[model samples]
Target: MSPSDQVLGTSVEAGGATGGDWVLHPDRALPAEPGVRALAREILSAVSDLPIVSMHGHVPVEWFVENGSFGNPAELLVVPDHYLVRMLVSQGATPAELGVPTRTGSGVTAEADPREIWRRFCAGWHLFRGTPTRFWMETELVDIFGVTQRPSAETADAIYDRIQAVVDSPDFRPRALLDTFGIEVVSTTDPAWSDLAQHHRLAAEGLGDRVLPTFRPDAVLTLTSPTWIADVARLGEAAGVDTGSYAGYLEALRLQRERFKAAGARATDHGLATTDTTPLSDAEATRLYADALAGRVTPEGSTAFAGHMMFQMAAMAAEDHLVMQIHPGVLRDHDPAIAAAYGPDKGYDIPLAIEFAHGLRPLLNAFGHHPGFRAIAFTIDEDTYSRELAPLAGVYPGLKLGAPWWFLDAPDAMRRYREAVTETAGFFNTTGFVDDTRAFCSIPARHDLARRIDAGYLARLVTEHRLDLDEAVDTATYLAYRGPLEAYAELAS
Candidate 1:
């Protein structure tokens, strides 16, 4: 018998949900109190099986186009996930020991073996307790892979072998799994200069209508980035527009945005260190662009240029009807040494305090009331949720509060977000949940968790007599399915 069969004393079929030894409680994330839990259960039953509308995430488009077999368990589950890598690294495990390749893609390290990495992850599985990562991991293993035994040093090999067998099956490929998971729509972030060959291929294969791209022009907007010049040149080449002057650069960005829209992109995403959006005069912007191109731009000049570019992007979004998404307040690469060795997204990005009221005034004032513009603002600074973002989104027809993201995507944080923002922004002023994950297998788990949390929050409203049960169920349905569809309507196939 195989290890899984030996462990379970029978062959565990994939997606059987027959792992009595490792079952997820039906009301795992519902309220603990019996009365509240009952209400939560009622609320959850209404929307539990609603089709998933994943508006924003980082899953590669090529995964669906290729439909290739996933490798061993560790490579699929642990290696590519920066969240797992960062946590293990914090607990004295090296990235190399977690099957993470070096910058040069070389695997000549101590943890090059997939089985060894799986063992290491199992050994440290306790580190994920009470974390969202743990919740998703459990769901993926037990519900998807049909593992009867919990992951630990004792059962590492058995679980790994079982997971590997499941992953290698035809049922585990991306397109089939997307259908299995009931994902109605998903978006992948792409750079402005991208040729979108993968997106084209997926479209040609008829899967492209469900998987869409999001335009992310951060590198082109940030004048101080090391690749800014090269990115600008590439943008010019791709758009067939000269970027030698500020006017030409703006035109190039406009062309790229049009191309992305033609390729089924509904939104443009921006990540800023701050929320500043001060616009510049044509003359000043032109001068700064010239200085930046000549490599003589100062720090202050770069910040001004970035802020102006944000305003410009807003104007372009207003014209093109693409939903604008701004994610700010992150100080990326908190530790330069680790960044130098491991490259970007090793999970060292830290949040900084941000004030959105004054910082975003210029952009909001210019487009907040525009008939065609819509914007969603996301921040790691929870203080801004009620104090700044909610109040702004409450009044501005153009602005909507993005769901709690990054460090604040946990259960408690999400509950707090509902309490803080719902009073002012109300239900419709928010964009519902955005998984924003890179882990493909965790997509369904993440969405399920969000739905449960929303149900619980709505149950409290029903108990408080603030909303009737029918209204609560309708609201839950909108949050789970309709909200994202309406918010990103332009991307709909």
Candidate 2:
């Protein structure tokens, strides 16, 4: 039998005043005024347990199939998470020592011990303080994993042992865990070169017909990133076109779209520094491709190649039934040393001031009016929510605004997102929350936060009589399930 924790622990010595498990008392979550809090609580209860519809996220499919005991608590929770790693790195910890993967075919995993990593991570728990990562980890440890005593160096061994014990059971496996979390569907990201054999295997084994893939061919379009030539060649082979030429390269991309479609891909994802899209004519495109092939493209030409490819992708979506997702404004791997030691996502990517107006013009102009084309744009720049994103989605027929992403994916962020987008674009113009995380176990936590925020927001609406309780219930359900299913259904199966 698996170890199960059933207590909401509080320790005066450790002081629960910290944000993690301390952010909200179940009762305190209601509101300041008793009557208002009660109403809010009632509203929140309506959507608390809706089945999760994860339209976007990142978790290895092997977790569901060969679900083994997660090696260690830190490996399960901290090491792979940049949200955790970046914070740790900020405190002078080195990624090399934290088992961060290396790009030069070497990895820090060699000399690292899981317990040592957890000890290091635990010592830095105080750094989390009021941050959302602190709150979520605290909740996961206390509320979910049954770790009552705050994680300090003293508690590392006990905590890891307990968590490992709990996870060793059949109940802790991926399918079982998803069941425990009431997940109905989960969409993972895959590159265009991916064969998706694992996804097919899981679907064949009957993982409740929920697990699926999203086609993310950023490596194909991101000429600035590594593996560009290989990615392009694979694109050509998949599409049965010559990738050596600009025209053939476009065909290769189109063919990969069909391949992903056949593999149950419902959407395509792109990671960019900005939402600004540039389109190039045939002549300009040919020149850029030639430069890229020759490894002589200037930085400006490289970025333009990405922008031009965005337009071409939109055109491909017009023909195929795939939804398009663009995750923009992240300056990936800002730390030179950490990036040198560890590859992409070694906890140094920072968000930038992403402008939607000028950045997205080229692609939007090309397909903004074309019916049957859907583009969902995501941004970490909260400043653009009401001012740029809401207004753009409000007017564009083919564009649907994605929710606040990455750093802005917390409960407060979700609430702020609704307040930001709903007034102008309205709820229908916005796709519901996508977890957008690589932490598999945290998917439930992310979605739960979104629902709680939505419920809390809708509860405010109901209390104000701006929305009826019945309507709030329906909307909550939609935000949790129907919205994602409708948004990504055709692309999946």
Candidate 3:
């Protein structure tokens, strides 16, 4: 066996032996103790095949509307995935070598061939060891593409050819794969100013019920954003309401919410640097809006106005019945050079320490008890899970704890999340698993991992005599399918 084979635990010859048999263990992520593992297996068996309800994600809607075949393994698995790009770049790989397109209109050079990119990825596959990205990619390769080899330099060409052939088939098209993956409902995030043309196309093609759009208005709320003026103007055009004044801007947002409702959107998503929700008085907010429109808003003014917008968004959600989803604490575009060259979502986003209890106090006090309002709060700060968010969601009728998000979406973190939140907020107050990914193929794998982790968590509860076996099974079903459905109930209705 060659050194590559030694790294991959497979036999390889100079003539390229077809890797090894990589089996996805039945209890891949379950507890190692026999009793707990057995119980986990039982719980997992009950919910493993449950249909996915992905209520919040960043998947491009055009893929489903177009129903086109994927181009290559690298495009399908690497270039578009920030998780992979970030890891590879951390290991001294450049975006250009990985076929990542530049935002400056210069296309990826010929040297960034798909085959070469796959080889680079294979060479660096060891870097993802013990990471959720590794698990997701392994599942996609072995389960979805039926690849029998571990990714390595020697097996890169063979694995790429195998995946390429699979993607070339009609069965691998986006719509077909949706059915194959048993995805019941998937939501794609769209800007408030979006036309949702692809969403409309999906509806026309009878797929609207399965694939839906989510309203994300962050760009318009950031008063100091480079494109804030343009985004607000676009919102005005889309809603047919003048947005020159703060009152008209609020009205434009309301109209856009109604438009989204008509287009089957059931939720509005907010990505904030802070979860602050201090509402400014009407006159104060109007002044800030005018300053922003004139490109004269200060940093302090921007922060104050953005917080005010979050409060106003909750009020609108209460009236419009759009479930509010807040994922705060991310400092996006951490590296300005990378962002300027490769564009946002090239994976420089980093998490900040967040204090959600006081940060969310104003909004919760204002609308927490509203009958029409529903909110799901997600965080990368584990400290907030038990100390702040869970306690808040435990009491607030409108607030639900969103699943472990972004950096916390790994197996151990998820397990910790259930342990921390379930004690205070309980299962029902928590929204179910959300595969918040743009990597479409990883959706099933991510959801599958969540289910297994939840099962393991519940299995330990059963072992502790805290839950009956039948009750645990039922809860597993809810966490896998019903929780998200109930959280976004308006969409189903």
Candidate 4:
């Protein structure tokens, strides 16, 4: 028997192979009914070739700047992927076993061998059954890397060898892969204190506006963090301003945003456990800032300060024309032990219930009608779709509901999102879709899944006599391509 046959545990056959070899059905995520499936196929075909406008994501800028080969399959696909690492950890796999890097002086040694990590992941592949992770991984394996065999203990070594060869090829370089993936513009989330050296390097190479940076100021804004003082200092140095006073700190943040905008940034991202945007009087703000700088800030002070900063961020967005992207209600590092051992993003962050109507009213009241200001709000809380978020987006001219994201970026959840928001908020009041991934290779797969789910939803709408076939195709095209472009129109400027 051939090695491929032995590894896949099946004999090769004509037309299509069976048994252990991985096969992605052409109708994978579509509606199962014949009539709806046919309509979905037509709708999907119309917009499937649109270039991906990944306006919000976590792919590192260094990947594009360096233009080097991926180290190995495990590093590219396993270690940095929280979606995969979280599932493996839940199924009795250790982060160290999966080669997740630990913090400095954490004394926890990660498994150093890439092959061993790959073996551990392959053995636990069943844990991802019926998950979005599995769907994305399968697409990456079969479509991107041309792997025909299923991942299992028996096939792990063979699959890894094949993937390693592909990673070593010059075509696998990050810049080359952008063309392969059809990404028109991809944004990297950068800290408030970033000097944007990597971004300048890429821009100087004439890759202007293709790769953009996003302003993320969570560390400097959170007064309760242990490193907040140092982070404030870094922000001051990066912005060439003093941060010793509250007024100076605000100016520093404004200057940083201006720097990001000059470097091709179109948005600022804020992640919080709550959605509070209450503004404070200048006196109160100065007092909190002084307390924070003196290391005497209370828990109440921190919460108040963060909410005030949210209000300030929105005001800044209005003046600067940078679209604001807010994704809140996530309690980071639920497991303290894992966080201490393996730092953050090992998938311990869990979602909490958030109230958007009351928490965001102050900010909306201040600038929701301003033509220059625009905000996209995302939530894992499905309950808010039709209740709070949809109604708010329906009325507020400056606000648009973000697509299903993070934990809610699955097939059923994506369909549910449309059902909940399309009534009140409608299609134009929403941003099409944001991949929001650090897993660079999975961007196309994630976008494809969203497109298929949306087509299926639009197909059902057509069959229900709500929308005509032509209208469905138009809406599908808008959701896939035009929505992002319109929402982030400043990018074109």
lDDT of each: 0.86, 0.75, 0.88, 0.90
Cα lDDT of candidate 1 equals: 0.86
lDDT of 3 by residue, 1-493 (tens): 3222322445433233344567667679999989989999999999988999989988888888878977988888998899998999999988888888887654444246899999999999999999999999987877677677889999999889877877776667889777788899999999998877788888898998889899999999998889999999999998898998888999999988988888899899999899899999999999989988887989899999999999999999888899999999999999887777788888899999999888899999999998888899999989999999999999999999999999899999999999999999999999889778989989999999999999999999999999999999999999999999999988322
Q: Per-residue lDDT tens digits of candidate 1, residues 61-99?
A: 878888897788987899878888888999999888887
Q: Tell me how far candidate 3 lies from the true structure as C-alpha RMSD in angstroms.
A: 4.9
Backbone clashes counted, model 1: 0
Assess candidate 2 and give its lDDT. Answer: 0.75
Alpha-carbon lDDT of model 4 = 0.90
Runs in model 2 deviating more than 4 A are 1-24, 27-30, 104-111, 237-240, 491-493
lDDT of 3 at 5: 32
lDDT of 2 by residue, 247-344 (tens): 88877777777877776777888886666577778998898898788887677887888888877788888779688898888888787766766777
Model 3 residue 147 distance off true place after TM-score fit, in angstroms: 0.5
Comparing 2 with 3 on TM-score, the higher-scoring candidate is 3
Provide C-alpha RMSD values for all models, in order.
3.1, 4.0, 4.9, 3.6
TM per candidate comes to 0.95, 0.90, 0.94, 0.96
Per lDDT, the best of the predicted structures is: 4
